[model samples]
Target chain A: MEITIAHLYPELLNLYGDKGNIATLKWRMEQRGINVTVKEYALEDEIDFDGTDILFIGGGSEKAVRMAANRLCEIKKKFEAYADNDGVVLAVCEGFHLIGTYYKLNGEKIKCAGIIDIFAEYTPDRLIGDVLLQSSAIGSTVVGFENHCGRVEIGCYKPLGKVLYGYGNTDSAQYEGVVHQNIVGTHLHGPLLPKNPKLADYIISRALKKKYGSVTLSEIDDTLELQAHKYMADRYKNCVRKKNDDDI
Target chain B: MTKIRNSLAIVACKLLILAGRLMGKKGSSAPGSIAMKISPGVLRSLASQIKGDIIAVCGTNGKTTTNNMIDSLFSSAGKTVICNNYGANMLPGVACAFISRASITGKLNADCAALECDEASLRHIVKHVTPTKIVVTNLFRDQMDRYGEIESTAALLNEAFEKVPEAMLILNADDPLCAQFGKGRNAVYYGVSEDTGLHGEEAKDGRFCPKCGGELEYEYHHYSQLGKYKCIGCGFERPNPNYSATRVDISDGLKFVLSYKGSQHKLELNYRGFYNIYNIIASFAVYETAGGTIEEAKKVFDDYKPQLGRMETYKVGGKNVILNLAKNPAGFNQAIETVCADKKAKDILIVINDKPSDSTDISWMWDVEFEKLKSANLGRLVVSGLRKYDLGLRFKLCGFEGVVIEDISREALEGIISGNGEVCYILANYTALFETQKILKTMEDK
Candidate 1:
C-alpha cells in the first residue's frame, strides 16, 4: 500500500520536536512494508491537500503560529476537504490551536483554518509538563508532554482522550485533544507518536482503510515500543497520584 | 555602616563556602543566595568598585564557553579576570562571585570582570552590574517552562538592553532574531561568512524576517537558523558584519579567518563544531572591540580548552571518552553532527536529566536531528539518565541500530568504556554532564 503524507507549515509550526511525528510515522510505515512518500508544505510552498492521504502539523511559537495561520488560510478549503474525506490528520500543540475556529490571544481573535470545530483561547498561565491521557480512540494510554497557554473548548468534536494526568484541553476540562472523523489535534508533543506507536499505527491503518476500503493492518513486534509507552504512562500516572496523595 | 554591612555579607558568604567545603559540596549557588540575603545591594556595590570594564555574555547556549573564552583572552593579555567559572550565571550567583573576590571594604581588585548571565536573569543582573560590553550569542527555543517562547526571551533581552543603552552590543548577524537586536543600535555583528557545509533540509527556527514578516531566503544555512539569509519581499538581508569569520574550516580543529576593518587574521581554534566557531569569533570580536590586540586573542585560542562537561576528554579503560554538553536542541544537533562527522565506529552514551538546571521538560529531545546518526558507524548506543528511555526511543525511532543500554551509572560507563569501539562519545544534558563527568573522574582515578 502507498500513502502520501503532507507536512503542513513545517518551518513555521516547527517547535517542541514536532518533526519527530513525521519521523515516527515514516519509520512505522516503512517497517510495515508500506510505501510512503512525504512532502513538506511551508510558508510559500504550494499544497495539494487532495492528493495527500495523511496530513501532519506540528507546534510552534505564538508568532510562528500567527505566520503559519496567514499561509494556512490560503489552503483552508483544500485542507477542510481533505479532512472531510476521512484523510488522517494529526495537529499538535500550536498546530492544534491553529486548526480550531479561532485562537483568542491578548483579547484579539486570530482566525485559523477552522478545520476542527473548536475554539482555543490563551490563558495567562501556561500549562507545562508531561501528560498522560487515556485515549478512547486508540484504546490505550497516550503519553506525551504538554506546553501551551491555549485552553481549547471542544464544541461539537469528539475528544481524543480523557485527561488521566496534567492539564489537557483546559484547566477545567477532563479531556485532551479533539478527534473529528480521522482528524486528531492535541497539545501533546513528545512529538505525540514515538512513545505511543499504537496511535501512529492507528492513524496509518485509518489512512490505509480510507484508500483500500476494508483492511486490517498486520501487527509487528511492539515489545520495545510498548515498553517505552508503559514506562512513560506509569511515570506520569504515579506523579499525578503522588500529587493527589500529598493534597490529601 | 556600609563597610559593616559589606563585611557581614562577605563573612556569611565565606562561612557558607567553608560549610560547603566541609560537606564535600560544590556550593556554587548557596553562597550567592546567602550573600544576596545578607545584602541585597552587594553585587552593585562590589561591581561599582571594579576598576576595569565588566563584560557580560548572555544567551541560551554558549554563554559559559564564550564567557570563559573572553576571560581567558583578557587574562592572557596580562589582565586579572574574575569570573563565575562554576556555571552559576544567575543574579545571586553572580553577586556571590563578586562578593568572593571583594575585600571586606567592598573593594573589587580585578582588572576585568567577565561573567556569564542567564538569559532570563540578564535583566536582574544588568540592574546590578552595568557591563561595558554585552555579547548575545544567539537566541534559540529553550526551557519553554521558564521562558515561554524565543520571541519572549528576545523581548526580555530587549527590555534589558533598553536599561543599559550605553553598553556595546555584540550580536550574531546570521541569527534572524539575534540580528534584529542590532536594529537602531550601534552593535558589533559577528557571523560565519563562508558556508561550513552544515546546512540541513530540516525545518529551522527563525526562518521569517523579523522586519517585514516575510519568509527568509537563505543563501546557505550553517545549522539551525544560523545562516546567510535575505528576504526578497522586503529586501531585508543579513547586515554587513563588522567582525566576521570570513572563512571557517572545521575539518580537523576549527580554523577560521577573522576579518575586521579591511584586515584578516587567521585563527586556529582547539574547539570543535561550527557553534564553537561562532563562540570563538564572538569572543574575539568582543576582545578586539574592547581595545585588545588580535595577536593576543589568537594566542588565547591556541591554548583555549572549554570548561568541564563541554567537549572535555578523559581516557578510561584504553578508550577516549569525550564529554560534550547538549542542553537544548540547537546544542544537541551540533554535538550529534560532531559525532557523526567521524567515520570511525564509536560507542555513544546519551544522558538526559530533567533536573531544574537541565530543563524539566524533555520534549526538546524530539527536536534534535538524531536521524543523522544512522549514517555514522555507531557501535553501542548506551542511553543513561533519568530520561534514558526517552533518548533510547528517539534513537531507535531514528533507525539507528546498536545495542541499546538504558541504565546510566558507573557500571554503564564501564560497559561503554570496555566496549569494542576505540572511542566513546558521551553526550549529556546540563545536570547529567556534571554527574557523568564526576563518574568518569572517579573511574579514571581508579
Candidate 2:
C-alpha cells in the first residue's frame, strides 16, 4: 500500500521548515521499501480526502488559518473519517488547529476537524524560539522551535506529550501535542522530523505494520541509520529542555 | 519632560546606527529583542498620544516601495509626511518617527505619518495606533521563515483591521488574500484590469485558495497569486476595486491608466515590471481616496522616479544595467518579464543567498519558473551569490546550460558586470542586494 501526502500550503503554514516533516515521512517510508506517492494540491486543484493516506498541515498566523478555514470546512467530514479510521495523520502548528477541537483564530470560533480535544486561543504574545518535547511513550526528548501566538490547552483527551522546553500553553510549559491512536498532531515545527529521526522512524514503523503486517529496514544500512539517530539525539539532548534558572 | 526623553531616545538610536555602520557591523538598524518586549498596544497608545494621522502600508511585497512612494507623493503635495524610509517599519521605526517629528513641547508637526510594515508586524502595529488609512499592496508567498502560510497572513490582517474599523483601507483587488480585508470595512480596492493579456494556462505550481481547496483560477495573472481569481466551489473571487487600472502597459517598468472617480489619469512611471505597476496603481488609489484630485496625482506620479533600488537604471562600464529587486519568485519573475519584454539581447545577473533573514529554507526557489528565460533574448546569464551552486542546479534542472556560475568575488563580479554585453540585468535577494549596490557604487565612483 502506498501513502499519499496531500498538497501542502508551503507559503502559508511554513513559518518553520514544517514541510520537512512531510519529506521525512516520505523518505523514512521509502527507506523501509514502502511505496509513497506525494502530490501537489494547489489552491485551484480539487481535494478528495478519501484517496489521501495521511494529511500534513503546517503553521501560519491566525489570519492565515482563518483564511484557510473555509477550505478546511469543505473537506471536514472526509478529514474526520480519515482520523476516525485510525488513518495516519500529522498536523503541526496551524495545521494542528485545523484538525483540532476548536481554533480561536482572530477572536472567532472556527470549526476544525475536532479529532483531538485541544482548544487553541490566539494570544497577543507569541511563543517564539526553540522548544524541548519530552515524550512519555518514547522516554526521550525532541527539539524544535515554536513560533505561534495561539495557545493550545489539553482538554478531555490525553496529552500528546509534555513540554519539556519552551512555553506550550502561552505561559506554562505543559502539553506539546495530541496523539490518539495513529493520528499524531503537534506544534514542533522546523526540520522537526530530521532533527529527531526517532519520531520519524516510529511513525513509519507504525504505518508499515498496518500496511504490510510486518516491516523491516535493510540490515546493510542499519548501522548508518542508528549512528545518525544517536548523533542527532545527542545534539538536541539539552538544547530544548526546560531551562533551570541557573542555566540562564 | 516627555519630549526631552523621546529626543534623547531618537538621538541615541541614530548614534547606535552610525556606530554600527562605522564598525561595519551588519545590524546597523537591528531592533533588539527589547523592542519586541514592549507590547504593540502600549506602543500604539504612545504614538496616538502624539498628534497627527497614522497611516500604514503592508503586504508580502511592495510595502517598502508603496510606503516610500506615499512619503514622496505626500511630501510633493507639500504635506509633512514623516516616515522611516530606510525599511525600518517595525515598532522602533514608528517610535523613531514619533520621537524625531515631535516638537520640543511634545506635539507632532506632521500632517500625516505613513509607515511601511512587514506582514507579521501588522498585528503589533495595530495595537499602537488606529491608522487614518491602511493600504495593502498585494500578498504573495514571501519569507517563509516568518510567515507560514498566506492564509495566516490574511487572518492576521483581518484581526488587525477589526481594531481599526475607523481607518479607511486601500486594498489590491487582484489579490484575494489582501482583498478579503475589504469585507465590512471602509476599503478601496485598487488593481490591474482584466484587460491586460491573461495567461491562457495557470501556473502548475504555487498556493491554492484557502476557501475552496481547489486551484484558485486567475483571470489574468500579474505574477504569482496577484490576479483575478474566483473559487469554483465557494464562488469566492476578486472584490470590485474602487480604483482600477484601465490599461496596464509594461514596455518599460510599469505604466498604467488609472480609472477612478469618473476620470482616467495616465500614470507613467520609471519603475519597470508588473509589480511596480500594481504599486503605482495602489498609490493612485490611496491618493484619490485621500481627497486628492486625479490631476494632482498625475503631476506627482509623472515626476516620481525610481527609488534607491527598486529599478534604478545606471551606465556601468559603458553598458546599461537596470538594478531591480527580486526577493521572491513573483518579484523575480516580474523583474525577468520586464527585461525580457525589452526585445533586446540582455545579459542577466541573478544572485541567490540563503542567509538567516533571507531564509535558509531555500525550497521556494524550486517554484520559480526559470524556463520563462527561454523566451528572453539574452546574451549570457552571470549567476553569482552565496547560493550560486543551488541556482546553477535549478537552471540545470530547468535545462539552462552555459550559464556562467561565478563565485561572488569582487574581481569576478566586476568582470561579469564590465563584460561584453549590451544590456545588463542584476537580480539580487535580501543579503546580496546591498552588496551588489556597493559594487555598482564603487564602479561608478571610479
Candidate 3:
C-alpha cells in the first residue's frame, strides 16, 4: 500500500522538532513494507488535500501560526472536504490550536481553518513541562511535553485522553486534546511519536484502514520505544503525585 | 559610603568562596548571589573601578566560547584580562566573576574585562557595566520558556543597546536577526562572504525581514537561518561588513581569510564546523577593533582549544572521543554535519536531557536532521540522558539500525568505547555534557 503524507506549512509551523512526527509516521509505514511519499506544503506552495492520505501539522511560534493561518484560510474548503472524506489528520501544539474554530491571543481573535469544533484562548500563564495522559482513544498512557499559553475548549468532540499530569485543555478540565473520527489534535510534542510508538502505529493503522479497508498491522518490536514511554510516564506521574502530597 | 559597601561585598564574597571550598561545593554562583545581596550596586561599583575598557558578549549560543576567545586573544596581546571563564553568564554569576577579580579594597586591577552576558540578562548587565564594545553572536530560537520567542530575546538585547549608546556593536551580517541590531548605530558587521555549502533540510528560523515583514530570499544557506539572504520587497540585504570572512575552506579544519580595513589576513582555525568559524571571526572582530593586531590574534588561534563541552576532545581506550554541545537544532545540525564529513566508521552517542538548565522542552530534537546520519558509516548508535528513549526513537525513526543503548552513565560510555569503531563522537545537551564529562573523567582515571 502507498501512503501519501502532506506536511502542512512545514517551514512556518515547524517548531520544537514537530517534524519528528512526520519522520516517525513515515518510518513506521515503511517498516510495514508500505510505500511512503511526503509532500511539503509551505506558504508559497499550493496544496491538494484530496491527494493526501495522512496530513501532519507541527507546532510553531505565534508569528509562524499567524503566517500559516493566513495561508491555510485560502485552502479551508479543500481541508474541510478532506476531513469530511475521513482523511487521517494529526495536528500538534499551535498547529492543534489552528485546527480549531478560532484562537484568541492578546484579546485579538485569529480565525483558523474551523475544521475542528474547538475554541482556544490565551491563558494568563503558559503551561509547560512534561505531560502524561491516559488516552482512551489509543488505549495507552500518552507521554509528551506541553508548552503553550492557549487553553483549548472542546465542543462537539471527545478528548484524546484524560490528564494524568500537567494541565490539559484548561486548568480545570481533566481531559487533553480533541479527537473526532480520524482527526486528532493535541499539544503533546516530544515530537508526539518517538516515545509513544503505539500512538504512531495507531495513526498509521487508521490511515491504512481508511484507504485499504480493515487491516491488522504486524507487530514490530517496540521494546526500546515502550521503555522510553514508560520512563517518561512514570516520572511525570510520580512528580505530580509528590506535588499533591506536599499540597496536602 | 559606597566604598565601604563595595569592601563589605568583596569580603562577603571571599568568605562565601572559602565556605563553599570547605564544604566541597563549587559555589560558582553563590558568591555572586551573596555579594549582590550584601550590596545591590556591587557589580556597578566594581565595574566602575576597572582601569580599562569593558567588552560584553551576548547571544543564545557561542557566548562562552567567544567570550573566552576574546579573553585569551586580549591576554596574548600582553593585556591583563579578567573574565568569567567558569561558564556563568547570568547577572549573579557575572557579578560573582567581577567580585572575585576585585581586590579586598574592591578595586579592579585589570587592563580589560571581557564578560559573557546572557541574552535576557543583557539589559540588566549593560545598564551597570556600560561596555565599550558589545558583540552579539547569531541569534537562534533557544530556551523558549525563559525567552518567550526569538523576537522577545532580540528585544531584550535591543533595550540593552539603548542603555549603552556609546558601545560599538559587533553584529553578524549574515544572521538577519543579528543584522537588525545594527540599525542606526555605530556597528562593525562580521559574516562569511563565501559559502561553505552545508545546507540542511531543516526549517529556517527568522525567515522574514524585520523591516518590511517580507519573506526573505536566500542566495544560499550555510546552515539554519545563517546564510546570504535578501528581501526583494524592501530591498533589504546583508550589510557591507567592515570585518568579513572573504574566503572559507572548511575541507580540513576551518581555513578562512578575514578582511578588515582594506587588508585580508588568511588564518587557519583549530576549531571545526561553520558555527565555530563565526565564533572565531566574531572574537577576531572584537580583538581587532579593540586595537589588537591580526598577528597577535593568529597566535591565539593557533593555540586555541575549545572550552570544555563546546567541542572538547579526549582519548579513551586509544579511541578519539569527541564531545560537542548540542543544545538546540542549529548546534546539533552542525555537530551531525561535522561527524558525517568524516569517512571513518564511528560510534555516535547522543545524550539529551530535559533539565531546567537544558530547556525542559525536548521538542527541538525533532528539528534536528538525524536522517542525514543514516548514510554515514555509523558502527553503533547509543542514546542516553533523561530523554534517552526519545532520542533512541528519533534515531530508529531515522532508519538507523544499530545497538541502541539507553544507559547514560560511565558503564554506557565504557560499552560504546569497547565497540569496534575507532572513533566515538558524543553529542550532549547542556546538563548531559557535564554528566558525560564526569563519566569520561572517571574512566580516564581508571
Interface RMSD of 1: 4.8
Tens digits of per-residue lDDT for model 3, B1-446:
87788789899998888898899866578788778887888888888877777999988778898999999998888888879888778787788888877887878878889999888888878766879999999888787756666777888889999998999999989889999888899899988887666777564778877666678899877777778899988988888788888678766888888888999888877777878878888998998887888898888888988888876788888778889998988888888988888778888899988887788888888778888888668888888888877787777776667757677877789989888887889999998998899889877633
- What candidate 1 gets wrong by more than 4 Å, as runs, is A241-248, B1-4
DockQ of each: 0.47, 0.08, 0.49
Best by lDDT: 3
Best by DockQ: 3
> What is the per-residue lDDT of model 1 for residues B1-446, given as tens digits with 9 covering 90 to 100?
76777788988997887798799976578788878778878888888877787999988889899999999998888888879888888887788788878777677788889999888788888998999889999887777767877877888899889999988899999888888888788788988887777776543667777777678898888877878999877988888898888667777888888889899898876777778877888898888887888888878888887789888889887678899999888888888888987777898888999876777778788878777877768788788888877777787776666647566788889988888787899999888988888889988734
What is candidate 3's DockQ?
A: 0.49
Kindly list the per-residue Cα lDDT of model 2 for residues B311-400, writing each as its tens digit: 787776777777877777667767667767878777788887766567544545555666778888877887777766546645643457
Q: If scored against the real structure, what TM-score would every candidate get? A: 0.94, 0.68, 0.94
- Higher-TM-score candidate among 1 and 2? 1
Flag the better candidate by lDDT, 2 or 3. Answer: 3
Q: How far is candidate 1 from the true structure (C-alpha RMSD, Å)?
A: 3.0
**Residue-by-residue lDDT tens digits, candidate 2, A1-248:** 57777745655555444545676677666756668887666544576666776667776655456656666677667767777776777778778777776788566788766766667887765565556667875555665666667787766555556765567655674777777777777776644565466777667656666565787654323333343334434544556544322100
Ranking by DockQ: 3, 1, 2
Show model 2 residue runs off by greater than 4 Å: A1-248, B1-4, B7-52, B103-107, B198-217
> To one decimal, what is the Cα RMSD in angstroms of model 2 from the true structure?
7.3
